[model samples]
Target: MIQTIAFYLFAGLMILSGVLTIMARNPVHSVLWLILAFFNAAGLMVLVGAEFLAMLLVVVYVGAVAVLFLFVVMMLDIDFASMRAGFMKNFPLGIAIALVLLAELVLGIGAYRAGALALGTPDGSAAPIVGVSNIQSLGALLYGPYIFLFEMAGVILLVAMVGAIVLTHREQKSVRGHQNIQKQVRRNPDEAVVMKQPTIGKGIEL
Candidate 1:
């Protein structure tokens, strides 16, 4: 009974927050509504057996709060009126792309019904794999046969991060006081260092 009430409470708030997120005139309010929706969704995930997913949702959303604030600030810079001006001009292209997607979906569904392609989901009569939680089973699967692939993915991510750092630190326009190693190395000692001849009681003018 408690679970039922909590589920309903979370689900109802999630739905209402989603609607408000779309309808709110203030972008900051919309983002706050969106965060509320995320929290309720996380709660619903917790009510289900997927505690890992719930924790993941909470951690990711909470950790990237800086990004949410950045988005709210950036909302002020958007030209909504100018974007709306292009709506009619872009409507036909959008409709055409959507129709193409719809057609693809219809064809895919028909082909699936005809069994022309095999989707590898388990059939309904398969016995439940008891004795283990979902996360444990997932970890075993990830680390058992695919550990090498997982390590390679980690390496790839490391390389990508290194590349990004190198790119950003390479050179920048209109930037103040970035170290130019070559320029510093090429400087004459006389120009680089000014010899100070000051009286004992006075300080040097910097």
Candidate 2:
């Protein structure tokens, strides 16, 4: 009964927050609603006994992705009125794409339900002869079977990070960077320091 109640509560909150995420006019408020939806979804996952997925949702999605979204929304100078002007222009295209995606999701779920797609059972049937913990099992499969793909994904993410840095990076003309530190250290005291005298009543000129 407790599980059922928690499930319903989480589901309701998730749905409400998801709707608010899209409906909110302010980008920061929308991101906040999205974070709430993620939290409720994580709760529902935990209630369902998928603690691994629940942790992933909380640690990865809620902690990193949602926080990044919040930061980006807060930092960006977005003109919502200009954005809204383009919304109606793309409404039909967006609706059509959403419908297509909905149809694809329905078809995928139907196929899974009908046993057209055979998913491996969690009873260690299709899993390797190893541990039963979800983390261990996933690690084994990822390292043993999908190592190349995993490495490829890491490389892709690294490239993406570099590209993002390059795009956002700028050279500051006013900021001086340290250079030739070793040379400066090896220089004589005469090159490094100078003592000067000025009139007692007047300040030294630059």
Candidate 3:
């Protein structure tokens, strides 16, 4: 009974949040709602005994992706009126795309209701390890047979991050108040310090 209640609560909240995410006028609010939806979906995953998936949803989607979206929305100078006008202009195309998606969804549902498509028989090659938690099992799989692949993925991501930084980096010309170490090192005490005793009524010359 508790599980059922929790499931319904999470599901309802997730649905409501998803709706609010789309209906929100403010992009930041939409991102917030999307984050909320992700949280509720994570809750549902937890209830379904997929705690690893739940953690991923919260940590990866909610923590990183949603936060990035929120920050981008908040930081960007979005002209909503012009955006709305563009949306209106592209309304027909949007509707057509939406209808195509709807048709695909309907077809998928119909296929599922009729019978699951025979993808392939499970050969037990990727079966979960017994007597271990799901996360431990996942870790074993990741760090065992797929360790090299996982390491390669990490390397790829690192390269991409470096590339992005390099691409976005700008070299500023004639930056104010910037210290030139070469100039400083090359300086002579004679030129650097002009020790002059000034008269009582006269200002010192530079």
Top candidate on TM-score is: 3
Model 1 sits at a Cα RMSD from the real structure of 7.7
After the best TM-score superposition of candidate 2, give how far the Cα of residue 139 lies from its true spot, in angstroms: 2.5
lDDT by residue for model 3 (12-65), tens = 999999999888888888999999999999999898889999999999999999
> What is residue 112's positional error in candidate 1, in angstroms?
7.4
| Model 1, CA-based lDDT | 0.80
Superior candidate under TM-score, 1 versus 3: 3
CA lDDT, every prediction? 0.80, 0.87, 0.91
- Candidates sorted by lDDT, descending order? 3, 2, 1
**Residue 87 of model 3: what lDDT?**
73
TM-score of each: 0.58, 0.69, 0.80
What is the alpha-carbon lDDT for the whole of candidate 3? 0.91
Better of 1 and 2 by lDDT: 2
Per-residue CA lDDT of model 2 for 1-206, tens digit only, reads 99989989999999999999988988899999999999999999888767789889999999999999999988989999987878878999999999999999999999999989998658753464454766677777888878999999999999999999999999966446657678778988755545458789885544
Count the clashes in each prediction. 0, 0, 0
Q: Give the lowest summed-lDDT range of ten residues in model 3.
A: 117-126
Best first by TM-score, ranked: 3, 2, 1
Model 1 off-target regions past 4 Å?
65-76, 83-119, 123-132, 170-206
